[model samples]
Target chain A: MQSIERLVLLGTGLISGSFALALKRARLVKRVVGVGRNIENLERALELGVVDEVSTDAAQAVRGADLVLLGTPVGQMGRLMQQIAPNLPVDCVVTDGGSTKQDVCALFRENLPRHLAMCVPGHPIAGSDLSGASAAQFGLYEGRRVVLTPLPENDLLVVEWVRQLWVSCGATVYEMSAEQHDGIFSAVSHAPHLLSFAYMNSVLDRYNAEQCLDFAASGFRDFTRIAGSHPDMWRDIALANRDSVLGDLKANVAQLNHLIQLLESGRGDELTGFIQRASRARIEWGKPKKG
Target chain B: MQSIERLVLLGTGLISGSFALALKRARLVKRVVGVGRNIENLERALELGVVDEVSTDAAQAVRGADLVLLGTPVGQMGRLMQQIAPNLPVDCVVTDGGSTKQDVCALFRENLPRHLAMCVPGHPIAGSDLSGASAAQFGLYEGRRVVLTPLPENDLLVVEWVRQLWVSCGATVYEMSAEQHDGIFSAVSHAPHLLSFAYMNSVLDRYNAEQCLDFAASGFRDFTRIAGSHPDMWRDIALANRDSVLGDLKANVAQLNHLIQLLESGRGDELTGFIQRASRARIEWGKPKKG
Candidate 1:
């Protein structure tokens, strides 16, 4: 095993940038090297003290690194893996910060040389909509959940090392199938975002029709604020996890339709019970996790 | 009008408490009488300087008031109006800070005396779930929107006076039909709350089933935090504006279902377009309004 004298993080956006900061803070790694398409972002990462060095060449960045984190968007991961897979040294642990694990793992399996047993597909469920290294903060992963989906053929040491990385960043690790991860996330995160986006559109349409946008208050602000998320990133997420997200969308619609039908039927008592049950459940389950 | 000496605010919660602060800041009223059932809340409001005085007796508090705001939950408005209606002086301008206007206005029309032309139904689109007068802060209404729904036969001077009061508090006032007001709010505010509540319930169910609660991150926090809102207040809102909320619920369900079906059919282009449109619309509508 090559000693991890240097760490190469691909695509230093929020997650990678945060990982860089956490690694530096924990003194887990000696040198942090950030690689991204945007030179400005690479410069910002260095300025923010998130990385010890910056590089634009994907292959050169990963050539001698003991650890490489594919932190690019899911859609862009395939191309990134293709560029870095050949240069990745033997016994070097490789992981990712992608939301969807199965596809990223598949990409690595297809592209990486057979000598690499260290590739693991992982996801850290700790991020804000804000992108780029500038938005990265130290506590981003504090007390958050990290899921590692390891291939059966992959060495257990790689999985453990990947887990340790997130743990150092203050994440609680979990083991799960990539399919399960995708489905569960689609239900919780993707569906809610899509709903928020669509709801904002409807309100904006109505307000624009009546020229009431200026009359909008904090209520509107609170509901649609998440709609301001990075469009390109979300676009990629929605498309990459299309199947699972679609399933969640169906469930969400069914739930809302049931609510609407009950209301249309003037079933106040049932509607009240439904909402009451939902409210009680949410109040009980929605407490924040410790960082 | 009788000499304005004292001001009494009923139900010293978020809106009332903020108004109390605004009134104190403006020095418009000589004294603030806070009436509520929770003694702790009353004391806390006093401790927080949200009110000059606190009381539990609805009638006693309104006896000498020149201006009184009924700041109780909408469901309790009818009963509270009955208790305070007979005690209000002839010259007192009785206005409410309830969200649902039509029902509250209907209650007032049936209960209030003819001389109380100052009885106005108000819906201030400002506030957070953190309730009670202690949550009150000055500048709460700055750049917020306040809607006043008055009956055609109601005194115009009284309506203008109520409008002027919110104006003084830095809110932009708009006049509209109670139906229109409820419809708009149901779409923008009430439905969003219900969605948040329901989504949080789903998250909780998953947590209970598989222990995923510990893994929730900023995305889940941002989406479900609002689910911790006051259940009683939401119950009142859902019950009072049942029909309009139901309409919005159905519309939301349809929108969600349409997106889901498109994704299920693998129509990436259409889904992308939909999200892009929604994102653009939300971006345009997301300008910050006052707290």
Candidate 2:
């Protein structure tokens, strides 16, 4: 694999910084430029060797870069894409580490129509509660999955290059349509997060919430752990993927209603079977699998 | 602390075996007798020194025991109570480790009416996915909380003795009405488990369920860990605490409905605030407290 001359990161943070560090370890790039509003974080990223140089301007950072990674929250990707669009090199390949894809693909088309052929929207499945440049580490993508939802106009070589970059970072890359990606994630990730948040608020609404929390044990701890996620980021996800998320949430409501009826009617056999299906599936999912 | 002559465990599982081991370690019990339908588990309990003797008959086991711990599922407690009622020593202090208090209290009233004065219904908050006598350990209850929902007919001395016994095992004991215990647990424990089961089943109903499971990351893992719990045990809890669980499930439904409205209208600020409330409360709940 040929090393890129310059790789620029927009919104240097956990996802971007980790990608930068992993690529640097693999010696896949020559110079790394970090762009972010937080000067302190950019300096920390530079100090930690996640990036060789730091730039506060996204446009200036992409001027000579052959690769640009949009690694900010989905809400900020559009403006950042607009900022770098005019200055990006004609051959520069663009990719992202956003959790959502369709909105990102739309942002790319709206802001960088000329660069659509070089743009490949992607999502690295690895996520952490921790954020900012300080949380980045080498090998963060090792054995992780990255889903690429490439645009229809994307150049074959550009998509291959983006896939190879992630592969070099020790991640297994998978391809899917933006719609499919959004739907799958909304079902597995987004819906579960919203359900957790809703459950937490419901618990908090109780008059004896403090007492309830005080007595809550490990089960409560694990179930609500995601409820403690970053509000702004989750809100962006909820809004950006509103359609798919709403569908899953409605499905969840239907499930809960069915459960309520079963409990209300004291259907022991059916209740046991309902729980049995879930238990069996979850237990099977937990088992070690052969390739 | 005075030691009982013999302690009989109604069901030789994690709860009962752990209690017996903890009591033996504190030298507060001279002998431990384990009664279970599974003779293999009974033999394992005896070999591991979790109990000094093993019995397959509840009536035979409680004949000479001065302390009888009903440590089975709530569904089995009533039957075991009926079996031992005629053979239980008049002065035996009967306590239980059932997760649901109200149901267990009713069982005691229905089957062991004559033993109510000596019966102290309790629930040890410590729980594990692992069960059977082989999963018992000496320090399982150390630093754990045990809620004792003593019946009105329970002698004050008997309640005190039960509290003291838990304290000797390094557990902090609390007292509350059986109603309160059921309500609190339904809100925190039972409701979350049921929601997880519902969510899992909802996912399984999807056409691309296998793909969703394949891509489910850490968030799904933690949120559904309890969904992998014993179906029989969870089904029993859901039915045993039906009213409280139903109320919570309904409240959860309302929360989900409110969230759906916010998402449907694309109310970004309100969505952020809703997520913020849940996020803030969950973070606060996770923090170390002074008390």
Candidate 3:
């Protein structure tokens, strides 16, 4: 694989900064240019050696870059793409570390139409409560999974190049359509997050909420861990993936109603069965994966 | 602090065994007699010093006991109480480590009417996925919280004795009504378990469930950790605390419905506010308690 001469990072935060660090460690990139609105974060990225250079102007940063990574919230990616489109090298491969892909695919089409053949929308399944350039680490993607949703116009070689780059950063890459990615993530990630948030709100609304929270133990801590997530980022995700998220949320409500019916009817046998199914599946899922 | 001459455990399991171990360590008990249908567990309790002796007969176990701890499930407590009613010494102080207090209080009223002054229903907040005699440890209740719901007919001294015993076991004890105990636990523990189970079932209902499970990460794992709980145990809790659990579940449904409505109408601002409310409350709840 050809090494990246100049790699431009649209958002120099945990995801993109870590990617830059990993690529630098693997000696797969010649220079990394960190671009962000926050000058302090850019300076931190430079000091941390996550990037060889820093730029507040995305267009200037992408002028001579062979690769551009859009590693920001889905809401910010479109604007970033538009800012760099006029100056992006024609041969530059554009990819992303966004959590949601369908909206990102649309953004790329809307803002970088001429670079569609080089755009490969991707999502790295790595997440951390910590953010900013300071949270970047060289091994963040080690043993992580990355899903790439390539457009029909995407060059096959360019897609393979992006996949190999992530592999070099120690990620297992899988290919799927943007629609499939949204559905899978909505079921596994987006819906669960929303459910956790809603459950937290429900607990807070109780008459003895303070007492309830005081008595909450490990179970409550683990169940609501994700409820402590950043509000703005999750809001963008909830809005950006609205359709898939809504579908799964409705499915969850249907499940709750069915469970309520079982409880109301005092059907002990059915309730046991209901709980057993979930318990068995979760236990099975928790087992170490077999190679 | 009158040292118990004989401490009888109605069930040789984690809660009871731990209580016996804690009391033995404090030298507050002279003998511990473990009674269980499973001869192996009883023998294991005896061998592990969780009990001084083992018995298969609850009536025989309480014959010379000064204190009897009914550590069996709520469903079995009534039967155990009935069995020991005839053989229990007049001066014996009978208490229990049942999770739900109202039902246990009723059990005391039904079978040990003459022992009402000595019947103190309590709940030890310590829980583990593991069970059986081997899982019991001397410090299991160290720094843990124990809530005692004393019956109005009970002698004040008897409640104080129970509280002191728990304190000796390295626990902080609080007094509350059985109704309040049930309501609080239902909101914090029981309802969360049931909701997690329901959420897991909902995810399993998806056509891409296996794929989704394969791709699930930390958030899914933490959210569903409680869903892997023992089905029979959680089922009993859901039934025993039926009214409170049902109310909380319904409230959760209402919250989800409101969220779905916002998402369906594309109300991004309102949706952000909803998530923000939950996120802020959870973050606050997670902070260290003020001195």
The TM-score each candidate achieves on chain A is: 0.92, 0.98, 0.98
Task: Order the numbered candidates by TM-score, best leading.
Answer: 2, 3, 1
Pairs that collide, model 2: none
Residue B256 displacement in candidate 1 (angstroms): 0.8
* Of 1 and 2, the candidate ranking higher by DockQ: 2
Residue A122 local lDDT, model 2:
98
Give lDDT: candidate 3, residue B95: 90
Each prediction's RMSD over C-alphas, in Å, is 3.4, 1.0, 1.4
Top model number, TM-score? 2
- For candidate 3 chain B, the 10 contiguous residues with the lowest summed lDDT are B232-241
Which of the predicted structures, 1 or 3, would earn the higher lDDT when compared with the native?
3
DockQ winner between candidates 2 and 3? 2
Q: How many clashes (backbone atoms < 3 Å, residues ≥3 apart in a chain or on different chains) does model 3 have?
A: 0
Off by over 4 Å in 1: A1-3, A25-33, A43-56, A113-116, A137-139, A207-213, A286-291, B1-3, B37-61, B137-139, B170-172, B205-210, B287-291
Residue pairs with clashing backbones, model 1: none
- Per-residue alpha-carbon lDDT of candidate 2 for residues A113-220, written as tens digits (9 for 90 to 100): 988999999999998888999999898999999999999999998899889999999999999999999999999999999999999999999989988999999999
Cα lDDT of candidate 1 equals 0.77
Model 1 over residues A1-291: C-alpha lDDT tens digits? 223578898998889888878877887888889998899999999998888899999889988888888898888888888888778888678888888776777787778758347888888887675788898888888877889988877888777878887888899899988887777777667767887877766665564334445555555566566677766667677777888777666666666766667656766677667667766655666554355
Best by DockQ: 2
